[model samples]
Target chain A: MAQRAVKQERAVRTREALVQAAAEVFGELGFAGASVSKIADRAGLTLGAMYFHFKSKEELAREIVVTQPARVRPEHESEGLQHAIDITLTWAYGLAEDTVLYAGARLVMEQEQFNAPEENSHRQWTDIIACDLRAAQAGREVRRAVDVEAVARLVVNACTGAQMHSSIESGRADLPQRIEEMWRVVLPSVAVPSAVARLEFGQSRGRRV
Target chain B: MAQRAVKQERAVRTREALVQAAAEVFGELGFAGASVSKIADRAGLTLGAMYFHFKSKEELAREIVVTQPARVRPEHESEGLQHAIDITLTWAYGLAEDTVLYAGARLVMEQEQFNAPEENSHRQWTDIIACDLRAAQAGREVRRAVDVEAVARLVVNACTGAQMHSSIESGRADLPQRIEEMWRVVLPSVAVPSAVARLEFGQSRGRRV
Candidate 1:
């Protein structure tokens, strides 16, 4: 029993290291330019070990793209529209420096290169935001006439564009500010007046969350 | 002189054919995946001819990205807010079928692969839209308090995101509709109420333009 536990812990460490290494490689070289051997070398592991952890480069890319939402966990107590805003803010803040997050973002855009049919990070994010908007509508924080799916899609797409421009303009240093601006213009259209007045767009809100 | 004119016409045809072939190859297999030889073959032209027109794939891709704004020429007499809307609507409509337009859009996103520093297609679109917004503000079609740059950036970014999602979800068939939804939510915040009432989002508006 003790031997099995030790082996399992070692496997976990190897998997984490491989993921981090793959993120750096993908971030630097993009999906097509990155090689599995290069990723294994960067991770200080052998080709056999990398194969043991990830079956192929496509699988690793898919894993990174799908795991993007999991990185932006809102630990704060906000819910509904505020919660949705905080989630995006948190994501924008993390995107400035997080290797895994930014690499996943790049992969999500270049995913067609790898020919993975099941990869839909944008849809996943839209659904997550739609859920929050639905909750907000139920609580009356959002307007009755607001289209939840459309607004959710807007949030996802706008954020994607904002980050793309931000990456080019400032290396993502001003991403949080861009997200704030997006919310400022969009909230008035979808949220109740009181909710709009009370919502926060601060970097600190994202950080604290 | 007639012989020289014939030579010039042949040169122009060669350049146009090369550009069209490059767009198709880039559209099919992204930048890194595309090759100069394949492009030359697709165009049914010699390698020497392609080099005479475009020195490299990066140069070709830059031309495509920089000329994206030129593709959305607003031929209509709508001089202010309406002109800006028509430009985007026209672009979204074109993205569905225009190989050059969609390929340019893709290259703009994946441009980091080619190492060109001067590619700022988003900035170009933002500036173009900002120009129209300034004109609209002067005409009292837009609100005095509206930040022209910010709104322009939003329009560019939201359209980028909207087309990306539309491409993924529906192969861009619904991109014009997505752009309309974007304007529907954003116009109330920037345009005067009267202008909002008058502005059109129909496919015919794009077609007419």
Candidate 2:
């Protein structure tokens, strides 16, 4: 049991190192330009070690694209829909804790490498968000007539644009706050008034924290 | 006098030719990779002539960044806000414009180029859109108290995302219609109810028409 625990911890460490190194390489060289060898070199691991952790570079790229630990966790099903969005964005922000990740996200998003299943797995985010919308509507947390698919697409697009702007902006003071403000304006359209009140503390937009 | 007029027109033609060439080069090579000699070559102009018309490559980039002559004509102003949006989107679709512009716009928005007037000039598009939003609101075409700036930014982002998606999706039959539908939802927010009813007389989201 101890041996297995040690192995698991080592695997986590190696996986994290690979993710950090890959973010740097992908950010600098871009998705098309980055190579597995370069990422392996940056990670201070052999190519074989990388393959041990990930089946291929595409698998690594997809993990980076989704950037959400919750998706990998078994307990996501227990979290409420809004909580899930909040968790995913927080995870995305956490992945961006490495400064290189901020740039990597931009490069990957711009290049938009979609052929690989790992990279394309980012689509799961939209579907997840859409499912959340459906759940919200079913629970009377959202409006009945709201088109969940469109809302999901728009939410993804808006958050993407907002995140890109946050990273690229020169004097961004509290970008997360700014992004949350965007959510405030958009949420009321689909949200239960009670949820909005709870999130807003009963204050109007531009007034709430 | 006629000889001078002929010279001026010739100069104008050469200037326009260079702009088109610069845009093409920028499109193909991206801003960081594009150079003046290549642009001049594409324009079928001597390098010296290109230099004579534009002082430097950066100047040409700035010009291209701000120049949307197809959408920025005086007629755009006369059409009023809703019609201006229609004309602008029509021009985007008409040119079969590339989504590469979003990358260009992203670069322009970086604001990392310091406080140079030329660099700041790229913000003209944002300002122009904001102006349109204000006009739209003042005309009672949109809801009051809405954050026009945020919505304007969202509109720009949504359009960019759609353009990029359409480029990748080979059977782009309904992509243009999707864009139009996006506008339908957006424009109604700004126009008065009666006007919204008058303006919106099509399928809300026509499939790839």
Per-candidate TM-scores read 0.94, 0.76
Candidate 2 lDDT, tens digit per residue, B1-209?
99999999999999988887877877666665678899899999999999999988777776755555333333322333555465445534543543334324434433343225433532444466677778767887667877877766666555544544444443334445655655554553455667566553233211112
How high is the DockQ of candidate 2? 0.29
User: Per-residue alpha-carbon lDDT of model 2 for A1-209, expressed as tens digits?
Assistant: 99999999999999989988887887676666678999999999999999998877666676676664333232223333454356434534443454444544555454445344333323455677788678777877777876777666566555555554555443333345545655655675667788666542111222211
The lDDT for every candidate, in the order shown, is 0.85, 0.58
Docking class of 2: acceptable
lDDT of 1 by residue, B37-95 (tens): 99999999889989999999988887778787877765566878889999998898887
In model 1, how large is the Cα lDDT of residue B116?
A: 46
Residue A128 local lDDT, model 2: 76
- Highest-lDDT candidate: 1
TM-score of 2: 0.76
- Residue B61 error, candidate 2, Å: 2.3
Work out candidate 1's RMSD over C-alphas: 2.0
Native contacts kept, each candidate: 0.53, 0.12
